[model samples]
Target: MTSLADTPKAPGALRYTLLINAAPQSSQASKSALRFAESLLQMGHNIERLFFYGDGVLNASSLTVMPQDEINIPAAWHALIEANGLSSVVCVSSAIRRGIVDTAEAQRHELYATSCFTSSEIGGLGQLIEALSNSDRMLSFG
Candidate 1:
């Protein structure tokens, strides 16, 4: 008789692509993203990448000035990404509109300068498209 422990389990792998569409300050989108990423890692799943569209790019910006007592969502994301070697792609158009441009662009346009947008790549819809194509599951958090 074969014991239950003798049975071989099939390998299961999951690749997640997360799309964030909400603003950073007014909603819990960033917080949810971080939690979901952590859980995925803990479960031995893979996070293909995080695509920030519309106001979601705010999650990667380093210049967010939340009240000292308030939680800093952007920083939380930064820490997660840095520690886990996660990929962060920000929509260039949305980022600029939201004042999250890099120093070079800010100098060229005389826009407000911040350190947050500099850490992430400035990309377009194509980046999100690629992420979705490469991932086994696409999750949208808003």
Candidate 2:
């Protein structure tokens, strides 16, 4: 198989949007997506948006308690997003359904607490569509 290092690099910085649809600990998809995003940024590409859908909404949850020996995927994602000032958005419906909510959402739904990370925001699919319209490429992992 062709390794990531063997992949051709873009000639110019391109805008990208990533769609992640797997849970943080459920599969390799979340890790792979993280690595890919890091690689892209390292190569000087711009991530226009990160749209987390389906189970991928779990990556934005601050309530995830990872084992000491395990990688904290959500925390990792938050760090990357914050460090790079990237636009990270979780699907509002998916996040709500999975019990991952921002303060506004929690209040709107009459929930007691907010579980979403500060670096990420709960948004609608319109954000995804806008990202798609503006980005040079869109990659989906799941």
lDDT (10s digit) by residue, model 2, range 92-142 = 999998999998998899999999999999999999999999999999999
Q: Lowest-scoring 10 consecutive residues by lDDT in candidate 1?
A: 1-10
**What range of 10 consecutive residues in model 2 has the weakest lDDT sum?**
1-10
RMSD of each: 7.6, 5.2
lDDT of 1 by residue, 1-142 (tens): 1122122333685788999888778688778877887777766677788888888887877877789898888887776676667778888888888777776667878866555544467778898888888999999998
Please, what's the RMSD in Å of model 1? 7.6
Q: How close is candidate 1 to the true structure, as a TM-score?
A: 0.83
**Which segments of candidate 2 are over 4 A away from where they belong?**
1-11
Every model's TM-score: 0.83, 0.91
